[model samples]
Target: MTLIYQAGQAQQTGQIVPQLFVSIQQPSQVALNGVSTQRIGIVGTASWGPVNTPVGLSDIAGYRSSFGEKQDGDADMGVAVSVAQLQGANDFRCVRVTDGTDVAATGTLSGVTFTAVYTGTTGNALTVSLSQIGTSSNWQLTTSHAVLGSRAYSGANWSSLQAEVSADGSAFIAVTLPAVAPALATGTVTLSGGTNGGAQTSVQFVGSDDSDARTGMYALRNQGCAIGFIHGLTDTTLAGVIGTFGMSEGIYMIASGPSGDTISNAIALSASVGYKSYGLKMMFGDWLYYDDDTLDTVLISPQSFVAGRLATLAPSESSLNKQIAGIDGSQKAGLVSTGSSKTYSSAELTELFTAGIDVVCNPVPGGSYWAVRGGYNTSLNTQTWGDEYTRLTNYIAESLAGGMGAYIGEPINGTLFGDVRASILGLLSDMRGAGYLDNTGTTVPYTVVCDTSNNPQSRTAIGYLQADVQVEYMGINRFFNINLQGGAGVSVTVSNG
Candidate 1:
């Protein structure tokens, strides 16, 4: 739908004569160029007024950038002109001197020289005179390398020194002397006649590396003062003695031997296998001798050990003799010889009585003389050899004494059983041929060898009979007999010739 406009807001209508008539309209914006007609001003009033423009690039009409222009400093973007530049700004003023007329061509009165005289005391009372030295382009102030001068005292001019300082001069703390330093080439800052000068105590150096580290002699003297560091004492007094003697375990001891006669160990004089020494000259442990040396070593052994050396040679006493004395080994009654005389020293006796058998056994014999007897004696003569023999026969006859009867002796103590039994038998056999009967008797051969069973009853009777027979012939020969009997048993008797 078409809308109608209000009266003042609508467009004005012109004559419709078609002479190409058109109403003109101003553009929404004018297209202008070059400098604009605009006042550059701030938005706030001058003293008290309303604002019109903002002080910024957007409020200005045209602007261009340039690169060459800079601020207050060099091209470097650092802060410029600190407070120090104001120090000497107007520090001095000049009074112009002219010839009372203008000189036309004098370019700003030539040039100017600024001089200020200072009136202060010389800094160091005693100055160090220094000079250049060495091939390098530097200076050295070392005491080891510094050249020394005779006398330097108070009021000495320090101007000739390497560098100057003030009278209250604590400022010159130290001066570095380079390897090529030219100062102190011919002068030195010496110490004299003060707390630390002129016949003063020596200076010392403390250890530098560590507390326990070893240092120079000066360091030891200074640091070890209260430490009581003592040095080892040498024995000069005994030095001569030490020279004469030899050393062992750090001790000087007298030498073991003298001159050319010394040997490392003790030596004995031994004869060579094929050579002999005819009276030797001798030297021992500092002792000298001709032929016989008093200083000789003797070897000895203990008593018990010495006794053991003789053990194999000595012989022991024998107990075999007592055993040979106890028993009868034979029954031939006569004077006869038997056994080894060297072995069985005494005569052995043989006796027989009425109950005697007709045959017997003999081991060794001289021949036949029967040591036999027969008798009847009353009154109970217990001392009767015949009666005792008869009793032995009775026991034998009854076979109560086994088949044989034996008489054995009272044995000596410590006697061996074998020798006692054999000797007793040997004794009785010896009596068989001893002619002990006071009349020679024919030997009755008893071939019956029988066992006497250690029967005490038969052995007593036989032993008694042998004792009586021995007693009866005691005057003829001091012989002993051990009689044995067999009852009525018959056989041929034999002997070892």
Candidate 2:
């Protein structure tokens, strides 16, 4: 019988016995799926749930089930999710932060102890009851909460009761049974002593970048988040931190100043930060006034709305003329709590735009609708200012990075070079077909070089291969002008075919 050897296995040059060897290679052509541009990351304080761990949520209901209801302030993660959902952003990665003083609510009944699964004031609302079931020896354990509703479990003994409740995927409380079963009684007990801890600082929201123990915003690294924001955080000092993270992770971050802030102050704050990055968008302090189910009318930072609007758009599209949903009003326009609506002057807008700041205002270039005034990021260079530039660039770069890894560990030869070029060309063609890369001129929208022309012998001899790619991103229509001539003063020329 012949012996078979797999790829990369060593075999004797001269063997008396017949032998067969097989070398497997990946396909030359690779297919790549574009990464999602709608996953928004949120880092903020919450009343419940794990701290510094990224949790994926689809809707406001999922957010509430994991993080509890919205608190009475801007730092709440549920509040951010609620506002972001208005713009049709359903995919989310949320990370909760705390001040290191939270405590879980607990209560004891007979010999059983029940504790809240998460540490927060919301857990204090949990109530537990035990009673006999219909004259039978089997007992029923019921747990109720204001938001989580009620659940009942029946078992013959304490051990069985714990197993039943645990198997049902309880979200609110954890049940502990005594070693020995006690006489069952009918009574209800409310959990208490749960604390939400102190308010988190800006640094806590930024978190650490340690790979082994990621926290806060860093916890969302490699989580496929395209856009991100820290709910209600207006501190400009940390703008560089978030901007750097966005640039490194390919996440477009949205940040805002305090509500009702002056234009001059906004400009000054941005100048002080001195951060000019294509990955971040800084909003002027025109906080949005939105109606909440529990808080009625509340003023919130514009970061969530901006992030959501961008998330809902295609990578090639801009948020400039898109109307923001769920906005009752804003600090600068419509009905204000303290004063009448204040419209920004043309000069004031110029100053804000010049300083790389954007605002939500009415009378957009299209019409009288609330939209992003300027489609810009914090980039001082005009080339990268438009939101489309940041998003499209990130999208293409990430897609290539994720798909090109298949070529690694393969033989470095002409076939490898052709494979690399083909993979890149395929993705670029798909992007162009999807309307992301376009050029009005006669030239093609993209170019890829992975052949021996760029990869010289000096480099390839040392186990090095390179591929260079360039893409022309579509531009946004920022300005439109029309020239008119009066009928009486101008002479018209008629053309005949």
Candidate 3:
């Protein structure tokens, strides 16, 4: 009799019987897909939701439903998301931060305790009521909130009433019934004692990165976020810290200085930080006057606006000359603070830029519209200063990191090198096709080398396989100059094709 063994199963050794062994192998060609470069990550305070847990938000309604509305401060996560949404950023991974003093609002009615779903002052707005249905044995339970709206449940008995509310209840509150059922009664109980905790410091915002329990900013790791910002954070001391995090995690971080800060102060702060990296983009605090739903017109930091604008652009595009949406005016231009409209002079802007600071102001190089003056990061190196360098480099690096693991266990041979090189070339070609890479003319925009030259016998013996890649990113037109000559006696020359 003939016997067959499944793939990956061992066959008996030295057996006289005939046996057939089958083996299955993964496809040699690996297709690399580009990671999403548009998703923005935000770490900030909120009135609701689990603390330090990353939540995906696509719209303002989802943000409100998950994280509650904007709190009464500048660090609200919802406010950041709202402003970012104005710049056409629809994808977000938001992490809510809170001090340990936060408390969930709760109330008791008919021997049932209702608690807010998450810890925040937004729970204080909830009210629950129980009433008899038309004087019958049946009863009705209703939960209401000003922002979350209202929901009602009807049931013939206590058990049924609890089930109905549990099945289709308000997302804002959770109902807990007592051990013993109580008779239905008509009364309203309002939740109170809810607190939003204290303001967060930079340490809390950075959070811990323990593999078992990540919190705050570290909670956003591996969330596929290409850009991130900590709302209202202007601490110069922490710039390098956050910049290092961004560099290690392949995320671009947008940071800012204090709103209404002076030019000298901004320059001094940048110099004091002194840490330069392409992973971070620091903005000059030309505070913007933004209309908030809860706080009315407030002067807010410029990080969220910058992050949103970057999120709306392609990986290779720059923020310079790109008009930012939903900005009522800036402190300098709108006269909100000084009672007089003041714009940055060329010399003042030059000083700020020289100090590695960028600002959003009126009269961009193109026109009088408000736009980013310089599309640059904190890096002093000219080669890596532009926003494109950080974004496109991270985009390509992350794409490879996500796809190159397939060759880890494969045999180290010529076929492995060819596959690896081909995979990288494929992604680079796609990038070129998508206008992310370009050269002067009639030349390939990238180069890939993976073979015996770079990977010798000594390296392959130790299971080391390396593929070196070089890509030329498309350049942004930062400056445009024109020569003009006009005189009555001067001759004009015209050229025709």
Model-by-model lDDT, in order? 0.20, 0.86, 0.86
| Candidate 2 Cα RMSD after full superposition onto the native fold (Å) | 3.3
Q: Which regions of candidate 2 fall more than 4 Å away from where they truly are?
A: 1-26, 163-171, 177-181, 334-339, 439-442, 494-497
State the lDDT of candidate 2 residue by residue for 1-497, as single tens digits. 54455544654466566556555544567788899999999999887888899999998899877888788888788878888898999999999988888999999999789999889988888899999988999999898887767889898878888888888865467888778877778889999999999878888888899999999889989999999988888888888888899989999999889878998898888899986989899999889888888778888998888888998899999999899887778877855446555677889889998999999987677786678989889998999998998898889888988988887787788888888888888888887777777735677888899888999999988888899998877778888778977878788999998
User: TM-scores of all models?
Assistant: 0.10, 0.91, 0.89
Error of 1 at 269 (Å): 99
Q: What TM-score should be assigned to candidate 2?
A: 0.91
Model 1, position 36: C-alpha lDDT score: 13
> How many residue pairs clash in model 1?
52
Report the number of the highest-TM-score candidate: 2
Clashing pairs in 3: none
Question: Which tens-of-lDDT digit does each residue in 1-497 have in candidate 1?
Answer: 34355444534666344333244443322221111111111100011001111112220011101000111211100000011011111111001111122111111001111110110011111233333445553433222102111122222222222242222232211233334433223454522211111110111111122335322111221110110100110112222222121111111111111222222221211111111111001111222111111112211111111111111111111111111111122211211233421111112111111111011112223222211111211112324222222222221222212211322344322232333334333333433343222234454322121223332445645543221112122121113487876677856589999
Clashes of each: 52, 0, 0
Candidate 1, after superposition: displacement of residue 147 in Å?
A: 99
Q: What C-alpha lDDT does candidate 3 achieve relative to the native structure?
A: 0.86
